[model samples]
Target: MQTEIIVAGFGGQGVLFAGQVLAYAAMDHGLHVTWIPSYGPEMRGGTANCTVIIADEEIGAPLVKHPKAVIALNRPSLDKYEPLVTAGGLLLVNASLIDRPVAREDVQAVYVPANEIAERLGDKRLTNMVMVGALLGATGVLEMNAVQESLKAHLPAKHHRLLPANYQALEEGAQIARETLAQAA
Candidate 1:
């Protein structure tokens, strides 16, 4: 299996962290993975994005021109990357931040109210985890257990207390995605 994914958002939206989690999960699952991140010069509120590639075999490059999946956390990200998704690819949109709907019919678009969901979960920082959960639910690229394990492995010990909340956010996002899939079916 081979999957190329792009996650994009503002600088503080945890886009790179989300990509890192996916890479870690892929590695834990015994797959080859590559993660490349790009961001604007400004630290906060600047554009940020990351490309992740996971494959069962060797990966030749880290850059992705047309990804198989995209997680767009803001309107800018949606505008920039939505059209570049490969045909029949998956596009996960953060509905809370992006009011514009994806226009493409070639790819499946899954909308998750990431910011709102994160807020409801009592912390807005879990937005990326929500997107990741939606991605996992929609694509099944990485198992949920693998993602949870990856989260545990990557988070520093000091922040371990927040794991449950993060896990809840992930599950909530997955539930939203599952509901969307059910409705589509």
Candidate 2:
């Protein structure tokens, strides 16, 4: 099976980092993976996005015209990618920064109050990890343990102190998605 994902938001929202985490987890699970990040020169507050593709077999291309999933941390990102998600795919929206709902009915949608959840965990920067967790829980693309291990293995040593809050943010985000799934069932 193959899954293509796009994580998009303004710079400093960890959009690239979120894609990196997914790539690391896919590699750790012995899957073929590709990650491509795009950003403008404005850096922080500028548009930033990354594409991640994971498959059990060789991936033919790096760029995707339509992704299986999208994690949109802001309204603009949502507006851009929501329509591109494949039918029956997943769409993870960071509701704290996005005021509206997902308008598409064909894709499974998970709304996460990422910024608020990260703030409760004592680090607003972990908003990316939270969205990553929501995607994992909503789509079952990768196990949560795989992501946790990736976070541990790939996080810089200087920032290891933030691991606790980061882990918490991930769990809280997953819980939100899982609860949403349960309600749907």
Candidate 3:
């Protein structure tokens, strides 16, 4: 089986990093994976996104017409990818940045206040991690431990001091998703 996910938002939102982390996790598990990043003309504060595909066998290509899942960190991304999620797929929205609600009933949409959650955790920059955690919580596509390990292996040494906070953000985001999903049950 294969899962294709797209992480999208403004450039500085760590979209590429988030996708890469997922790819790293897949690779660490011996799963075949591919990650492709797309950047807009403008850099930080501009549009940026990445597509990650994980499968049990060799991947044929990285291109996808409609992904199985999408993490939209901003309104523009939600607007552009909302209708592109395959039916019965997943859509994780950052409620802190997106004011509107998910319009697709065919997809399981989880809205997490990533920015607010990260801010509460002491760093708004950790929003991407929060969303990543939410996706794990909602779908279990990847194991939490693997992701944690991936972060530890790849995070720059200079930023290593923030590991505790980053881990906290992941748990907090996952908790939110668990609660939300429970309520909808």
RMSD of each: 1.8, 1.9, 1.7
Each candidate's lDDT (Cα)?
A: 0.91, 0.89, 0.89
Better of 1 and 2 by lDDT: 1
Give the number of the best model, judged by lDDT: 1
In lDDT terms, how accurate is model 3?
0.89
Give stretches of model 2 more than 4 Å off: 39-45
Clash pairs (backbone) in predicted model 2:
none
Candidate 1: tens digits of C-alpha lDDT, residues 97-139 = 8998889998888999999999998999999999999998887
Off by over 4 Å in 1: 39-45
Q: On lDDT, who's better, 1 or 3?
A: 1
**Estimated TM-score for each candidate:** 0.95, 0.94, 0.94
Per-residue C-alpha lDDT of model 2 across residues 1-185, encoded as one tens digit per residue = 88999999987899999999999999998999999986456346578999999999999888888999999999989999988999988889999999999898888889999999888888899899999989878877899899888888998899888888888888888999999989977
Ranking by TM-score: 1, 2, 3
lDDT of 1 at 61: 79
Error of 3 at 76 (Å): 0.4
- What is the clash count of model 2? 0
The TM-score of predicted model 3 comes to: 0.94
Off by over 4 Å in 3: 39-45
